[model samples]
Target chain A: MTLRAASTAAADRARIRAGEHTGPTSGLAPGLAQANLVILPADESLDFPRFCVRNPKPCPLLEVTDTGSAHPDCVAADADLRTDLPRYRVFRDGRLVDEPTDIAQFWRSDLVAFLLGCSFTFEWALAAAGLPIAHQAQGVNVPMYVTNRRCISAGRFDGPLVVSMRPFAPDVISHVVDISARFPAMHGAPVHIGDPEEIGIDDLAAPDFGDAVVVGADEVPVFWACGVTPQAVAIQARPSLAIFHAPGHMFITDRHHDDFDTGESHDHP
Target chain B: MTLRAASTAAADRARIRAGEHTGPTSGLAPGLAQANLVILPADESLDFPRFCVRNPKPCPLLEVTDTGSAHPDCVAADADLRTDLPRYRVFRDGRLVDEPTDIAQFWRSDLVAFLLGCSFTFEWALAAAGLPIAHQAQGVNVPMYVTNRRCISAGRFDGPLVVSMRPFAPDVISHVVDISARFPAMHGAPVHIGDPEEIGIDDLAAPDFGDAVVVGADEVPVFWACGVTPQAVAIQARPSLAIFHAPGHMFITDRHHDDFDTGESHDHP
Candidate 1:
């Protein structure tokens, strides 16, 4: 199978819905905003949104669908939440049940879906600004680790923060920060810049999740709050039922990544 | 009778608690952040926070208290929410019931309090940058209007967007914008720049709320999403019981105004 950038978000999602695109959505629909999807029962809906609000860096909420509704009206027009994503992970009582291409069979009227902003939007910005993405260059997944920092607990959601890492030359870190900071809807800027041990990462080559990449002698490991934090928290909380997009496979929204640029509008975030 | 700047936030709040201070909290504790307060029952708790998240420009939430608690631990350390402000307005089923200095008698275990960032933080930034405040200079309230723009509805809280007007010299508008844009927690930047008619303001002399300030011939009227928006929406929604700080009698937080400068820490917002 050949990997190519789809020209339109609608077309890309159509392919995913039709089962023609089942691989990771990392580079598909290049300029479109990709989101992490989390579906929970209505019983847990109130606390979950509050959790996202309390820990915004790791869980920047884009749009939360009304209970039992599959449409995320804020980010996309007439998009179905249950079938838009490439793949999904279903958890029963906090344990991974299965990874499936479509969740329409498991859809329940009591479920609420939350669309969270992903770092891919800012990665597009960083790459456009000439910053190299280590994982993409190495043809592997971005390194992720469980940080020592704990997210503020909301109801049943509580866990350590998770971060994704990218190595950048020391001289260009400031430029990298500026470009990424403009999109707070996406994980805004690097949470930790220089040292890995300070954030409780024992080694860069051994990421808790994703593939490891080489860190140059003069490069610093930059970490951004990952959308995985919320998923991890949801798992640890042991809710009776929960659903999330499989890692690296995201829901593509109609909004372009640059549409989230700060100061463009008052309500972007 | 002299409205001198209190030496510190703690001192200012103490004076307000003791009834020694009854004037508007503007400039009372220079450099400190002032907040707009809203207290609602737990039954309406879930939707109110969602409303703030949806319309961040008009209702940039600073801190939301634990259910039934009167303390805002994030913004001010050990500050009592019930009696710390100079005045409060009580509403019963959306109608004004009473104006009280302390809401101790009305406090209930099922109530939740939200502290929203106020324009005073950015107004301080504007003054520090040497931009004149028209209302303060003229000894009147800042002009505010209910625009035709409707805030995205969250649960039952739905209403038109309310904006505060500040006239700035055409040449200095950019400087004003640059400074205010840095404080996203405090209604960052102007929503509209010049023509009020564009956002549906008919008469400049008459505003839906607040006193009208003069719009100099060479000055452009800059409008920012007002903090009063949530209060207006709450009133319109008509929750069973609601409490809010009286107009201009804001709650002062220990954090300095500039402490909310963007990109400082992930948890600030």
Candidate 2:
């Protein structure tokens, strides 16, 4: 199947819903908001949101669907979560069980869907400022590292913070932080910049997830909280069932990148 | 037996904890943050926070304590919910059954306490700007009304939006909105202004909660989302057990009014 970019989120979702589009949503619906999806049973609902609240940097909550409901109330009123995304990975007991285009077969009355802001929005902000994105340039996944920092635990959810790295010149690093920090709903600002070892990231050449990029001699690698943290933590809890959007496949919403902008420009952890 | 203001929030809570101060927290801990407390059983916990997330104007959730844990993790890490507040109201199936200074006996392992941002923060912001609050001037409660507009529901927790009225000159109404709008965590901006009838407020002389204040001949009434909203809505849910901070007996936190300030000056719903 060929990948295509649609002019609008509605168009993109419609194609994906009808099974005409089954590719990653990276460039589709260019300006509209894209979210990382996490569906869990109602029993685990409270602790999950609490986990997001406690570790906002890693998991900026966009909207949470009502228990057992596949339709979102805030992000997109009419959009159905079960079929809106291009792909979903179903996890059973922390292990990947299946990858499906539609989750209607697995929808349960006790399940709740949580939509979290993705780093894609802030990447637009950085790209708009002419800051080159390494992964995009290299045609590979953004390098992500599991850090030594443990997120504030809420009930059954607790794990090491995961951060994605991007190297930039020292002088432009402040500008990069300034641009990204304006969107808190997205992964805002860097967690560590100068020394990767401080955050337990021993080597930049090898990353736990995604492809690693070479750092220029004059550039320091900057890190931002990744959306993968919640998925990692949630799976670490070993819940009986969990569902996530496949890598690069996200839930598209009508909201745009500017919708997530915060007034504060201060770098957030 | 006497109500007195303290120099700081810690001092005020210390007195309350020791049973030395059992009065309204209005003037005590002047600059510190005061929150509206809501405790619900585990079954109702998921919907309650979802309700707040959906209706943030009236219920900006500051923190949600872990189930059965008296120690708050966010608003005040060491503060004990069972005894820190001056007073608490315990409800059974929506009926008020007990008013107590200490609720250690009622504490259950399944209870989850939610701390919501109170209007007291923005009232300070308004007062700091020399805005004369009508109720403060009249030495009466800030009049509140149940609005015609129902809030967006979040399974099992749905009710009308409640708003508190403050009369201000039309000339400075925009400024008032701008100032309070800077604190989205506090009920940011007015929901309705001018005649109250538009929002189902029929008589200005009578209010659903708090005492009524006379509107001036030259001033218009500005209605802000009130903290009473969550209490009214939560009780309406008829949860088997619910606990709240009694009127004027809020849970004081170490954070101050300035801490709630947002960069946005635009009025929010």
Q: What is the lDDT of residue A125 in candidate 2?
A: 82
**How many pairs of residues collide in model 1?**
0
For model 2, how does the per-residue alpha-carbon lDDT over A28-73 read when each residue is reduced to its tens digit? 8887779999999988666888888777779877788877889876
Residue B252, candidate 2: Cα error in Å is 1.7
Q: Which stretches of candidate 1 lie over 4 Å from their true place?
A: A1-7, A263-269, B1-7, B263-269
lDDT of model 1 at position B196: 85
By DockQ thresholds, what CAPRI class is model 2? incorrect
C-alpha RMSD over true interface residues, each candidate: 6.3, 10.2
TM-score of each: 0.91, 0.85
Candidate 2 off by > 4 Å: A1-7, A124-141, A166-182, A187-194, A213-222, A257-259, A262-269, B1-9, B125-140, B167-182, B188-195, B203-205, B213-221, B256-269
Write candidate 1's Cα lDDT for A149-192 as tens digits: 99988778889999999999887888777677767778887788
Whole-model alpha-carbon lDDT for candidate 2: 0.83
